[model samples]
Target chain A: MPKPNRSFDKSLWVFHVNTGSCNGCDIEILAALTPRYDVERFGIKLVGSPRHADALLVTGPVSRDMVDKLKRFYEQVPDPKEVIVVGSCGISGGVFHESYDLAGPVDRIIPVDVYVPGCPPRPEAIIDGVVKAWMKLERLRGENR
Target chain B: MADEIIHFVEIIIGVFLVAVFGMIFGLLTKGIDRKLAAHMQWRVGPPVIQPFLDVKKLFCKENVVPRNAVAWLYNVAPIVCLTSVIAILLYIPMGSIPPILKGYGDVILILYLLTIPSLAMVAGGFASGSPFATVGAQREMVLMMSYEFPLATTIIALGWKISTLYPGEAAFSLTTFTKYPVWNIMGPFGIIGAIILLVVMILVTTGEITKVPFDIAEAETEIAEGVFVEYSGRNLGLFYLADAVKTVVMASLIVALFFPYNLSTYLGSSIHLPSIAWNAIDFLFYLLKLEIVIFFSMTFIRVSVARFKVDQVVKVYWGYLTLAALIALVLIALDILL
Candidate 1:
């Protein structure tokens, strides 16, 4: 495996995934991309396909139905990938905890490198989560080299 | 024998030079296009070197071929697309420099060569075996067939006009286009005809490059990147580069056909620069023209419109644009007879 170098850190094309969250976190994720927030200034783009993504921005708790599909999406992302859990639901199942439709938090299904804690995190918090994503990338670099 | 060997080596060198030029300028233009789009939307964009970073990062990532994919074809498709777009560049005159393969091909040959990249994408889409890719490929073929007619009419109408004026010359050649520009040697009616054809060509170019309104084939929201859904890492990177180069190719085609004037032609007599310096100046001017064409065709129009449906794309191209091209053709025909 090639070292996940500075270029990898600089250009992070993220795929946004919604397991079962309310539309709240999804809208915030979009807000981060709007002109006011403009995550693209930092080369953090929201792409449609996982194959073209370097990171996954996951919202919502892992529901029963989404567990298998979420796993497939995680696998589809090319390797040297990071997962950023964007809302409290994805990190701890939030309001959906122990519910019949739930499959637990995102961490159980895939390794999550960063977390933004909010019922539906602010766009600012999501941007911070992306910055925190680089710390995980740095740690990976240290482990590899 | 020695002279022939040397000539062959020069052609090889020129081909490499053209490829390098296309890749560098293509990426730069894409970055600029992105930045301009950001500003148009009132946002601060990524750095101009953003594309370079993306391509470098992509190369370092793992290449994933889906389980159902024809791995060989999936991999070969991007390579074919990139090389074919570069091959088309070899036939287009750059700045004051004539085409590398000047006599080997002409406008008619380039018209055929232009389809190759899209065709390669279609083949790759089918080979990927994804349902989305298949639908995208079908849309791409539909879009391809729709645009080719207006594109051909524009080229043929101009070529016919030139053939009449320059009797016995290679009217369909890019060299001929530069020398006997369609914008020149035309009366008021022909000029209007040429402008209409220019608009048609620009819109055709928009469809060809698959920007927003015409990007039904790669519609991100509708199809999850459609034909490229299965492609990852280096293969995606190649497609990215090919898209950038194709933008330059289409923009350059517009430049060569309609806006073929160089700055040095007017300034050289007064400035008294060396021949080499004049070539450099003309090259910069050509780049400016390319930027203008790309702005109007790719950036401005793309930012303004929402994506069209599959049928709307066909209707716009076949019903409206083809009609516009025919009107221009009739005007040019009238200019000749009058």
Candidate 2:
């Protein structure tokens, strides 16, 4: 796949997807948008619809019931999109790793470009993760060129 | 025949220039609104160039057409919406200058043109075949119906007073408004009534542009961006531009109707500036007026209020605001008689 253009790099509209997380990570994601962090200064807005998003900020370990819905949401985002998996649960299922209804770690279900690993990552870490995603895009763009 | 041809060329050039100006100024105003709103909330907001960058990024993204959508209608709607808004700018005066299509249309014509963008949005939503969009479309129709009454009453009240003052003149022509500023024509009672009408128009503007408080149709949290849920990429960018331009149109309308005073008129003889300098000063003053109008009617209100429910929007516009407008009309009429 071709790398996203420079304009996409400048303005990243993200859609937050929750896959049965314990609400901790999701709250941190919301915190990233509050004035304390203000992701909007970097042109990173939380969009309501996946169609309008350039990135998917997926939280939670994948629960069995949410896997299909999460996949559907990912497909809804238009091309030249990145998926950033947030929270420890999304990476290794954390406390829910051996739970009965578990289907995640999110990377098993979809290609993940960045991982922000904390029980609930701090807003600063979340912002850092986004910047990492930008660097990945830059690297991909260089490879394509 | 030769004269007609020359006139036609002038019109073509004028339309092109107006379209470009409308788009640029519209986006600029939107950027200002965001910056002002952010400051009001005690945060450093996105830069003024954010909207321009957004439109550019949107253009670069992939266009996604939903499987269930009527592709042709879905694609055509944004183009139509933007065109209609630009057309409204043609009829409404800009700064100290008359409208490009001044003689051909009037306030009444503008009233009709205002609805076309919303209607086009409704049609586009329905064609998208999404349930969320359908609900948003229905709310938009209801919101349109609710606002039109007060909007029409205010326009008619102004036109009625102007016609009474000058019997032989075209009652609804915008030129009449420029000739006889509403403040100059009114007595004490009429002035109060005119202020009420101005408030009604400002409130109507919040609805007309579908900003926060009246933005039930596109309540992102509730309906996932509603009528625009299925739109992406280039189509969404067009809608974004349409919205920005519509802001300019709504603010300009308020300026034309109530605050059409030109700086050049007041400062021309006093200051020994040249004609071009005078025009430039007047244009800058007009921009200031636009910023103030937008700040009060859009940015301040948007920051202060949460989105109203669809039913509450109807109640606010139809029930309360319409009555307020009617009272203003009555007061204006009484002023004329007394």
lDDT of 2 by residue, B1-338 (tens): 99999989988999999999989988889888988888888878888988898998888778988999999999999999999999999998766777889799999999999999999899889988899999999999999999999999999999999999999989898888877889999999999999999999999999999999999999999999999999999999999999999999999899889998887788777888888877777778878898999998999999999999888999999899999999999999999899
TM-score for each of the candidates = 0.99, 0.98
Model 2 chain A: weakest 10-residue lDDT segment is A1-10
Give the per-residue lDDT digits (tens) of candidate 1, residues B1-338.
99999989999999999999999999999999999999999999998889999999988889988889998999999999999999999999888988888899999999999999999999999999899999889989999999999999999999989999889899899898898888787888899999999999999999999998999999999999999989988899999999999999999999999989987788877889889989998899899999999999999998999999999999999999999999999999998888
Off by over 4 Å in 1: none
Candidate 1: Cα lDDT at B114 = 93
Candidate 2 regions off by >4 Å? Answer: A1-3
Q: Native contacts recovered by candidate 1, as a share?
A: 0.86
The prediction achieving the highest lDDT against the true structure is 1
lDDT of each: 0.92, 0.91
